[model samples]
Target: MQTLHYLTLSVLIPPLLSFFAEPGALFFEGGATNVGMIMDWREMAGRPTVRGMQGEDRWNAYYGAWSGGKQLGSGWVEGMWDGRTDPMRGWVIAFSWMFASFADIYYLCILVRRPRLLLDFALTLGFSHIVLTTYYSASIPTSLFFWIVMFTWSATTVTIAEQICVKREMTEGLVISPPRDEVDDLEMGELLRRD
Candidate 1:
């Protein structure tokens, strides 16, 4: 369950955030740099350092900072401090949806116990992704359909897990073990335990 939650957030959150917030804003406005920060630290280290806004600055920050610049004709080290390229909205949506779908399928395989149930859920999930990929529509009805499938899958997994747990509990105390000592065959065919 926790795995499901984490996978959901990781696969959904970043692109959703990018929709509203500028990618640059997602990072510090005045970028900070330090041994740790330059080392890709997300938080302040022992010492605090501040970096100016990332863009086509004298330091040529944009080249490394913006995929826009990287994807365009800008050289690997050149900075595009002045402007941004196309957001590639369609590609972003497509990739995000596909990635989330893949993650869900992988996690479902791990969570579901019964092979038949797993196959059913997996087929449903694959179809849902196909609908999404084919339409690329965010209409309310489409969104609702996606959520419904997701919820149903979650419910089924929980129910199956509970059933398994209950079964294990019911049989736990009734488990039988073989005799610890060796057993020998008697003349009449009955087995006798040897001390």
Candidate 2:
């Protein structure tokens, strides 16, 4: 049931958002701005503030090079630094994602009971969000790394979800079992004999 709820929330919510919000704007660009805490006055302002205006100009020039537009050339680093310093508003967005990820991990821990798989999924998902929220502050290489982590997290999470959903035996109560290795039994016997 927890697994089902997690899947329902994770799988359903994003597509629902896509119906209302502009696609890729929130995903690729710094458009999830309103999704988290509104720390800046500009963010709350109905109209664009100075930083928003400046950030948009900076964003265009930075994204311009990749889009085959004129490059920032020597001014690239300075432009990046300027964008990184503006406001810590991005952290609020990141924190919201982080909290959601944490809740998912907690539910998974109870649902799966498989430590290794759960750990891998949780860590990958956690790091992906961390990288994701840092988009405002990240450079080109770091942004590329974030994409890589996002892909890895997606693949790992899908696999784990599939395993949980398909296995009917794991759908209920604590699925505990003792270690099943003969080597461990032998080691235990040897220790008992020594004592």
Candidate 3:
């Protein structure tokens, strides 16, 4: 049950955050002919062309943004920083994924409250990323940059969560004392013996 909860959150939260952050990536653009229809809900709901892909082609490009895949372009470093191309959008998306990772880790720490389990949680998140990317793209993601980003996300999350949990544990002291009844009985016995 705990594993199910961890895996579900590990797979779901980051992508949900990405969707909220970059909703424009999910819509089909009609170019100059439909300049006024840019934010059409109908387009977003149906099989919208993502990054110039349509219908079945979109499946090959459905890499999750949380996994370092961009809807507008290739999420790989080579695609983002190609020698004559502007890389601003790619960098922004990457940072957003990192930010989402922070939130995900923080929430997990609060819920699980076990520092030792953080590594396992982080691994689950990384595995989910690989599975999602592979499933969506229909091929193994061989991009070095993608794997690096995924590793960075997992490492950073575990490190920060551990730090936070350790600090919290240190600050929260446990109080251990004898029962009130035992204390009273000892006090009465001492009084009787003295008299």
- By TM-score, the best candidate is 3
Please provide, for model 2 over 1-195, each residue's C-alpha lDDT reduced to its tens digit, 9 standing for 90 to 100: 334433434543444444544443333223343322222222211112222324455454432211124332322354332222222332332333333444564466567657456656566554544454345333222334334434454455555554664463455555665677976898899999999
Instruction: For candidate 2, list the clashing residue pairs, or say none.
Output: none
Q: Provide the RMSD of all predictions against the true structure, rounded to 1 decimal.
A: 14.6, 15.3, 11.5
TM-score of 2: 0.29
Give per-residue CA lDDT, model 3, range 1-195, as digits (tens). 234433444454345434442333322122212311211212212222233235635335443232124333343344341112112323433554476577767676787678898888778766875675466545565655555666787888889988888877877765667999999999999999999
Q: In candidate 1, where is summed lDDT lowest over 10 consecutive residues?
A: 40-49
Ranking by TM-score: 3, 2, 1
Compute the lDDT of residue 103 as modeled in candidate 1: 57
Q: Is candidate 1 or candidate 2 better by lDDT?
A: 2
Q: How high a TM-score does candidate 3 get?
A: 0.48
- Return the candidate ranking by lDDT, descending: 3, 2, 1
> For residues 32-135, could you state the per-residue lDDT of candidate 1 as single tens digits?
21112112112111111223245556544433232223332232434432333223322333344344555555565557644446556655654554454334
Error of 3 at 23 (Å): 12
Q: What is the C-alpha lDDT of each candidate?
A: 0.40, 0.41, 0.51
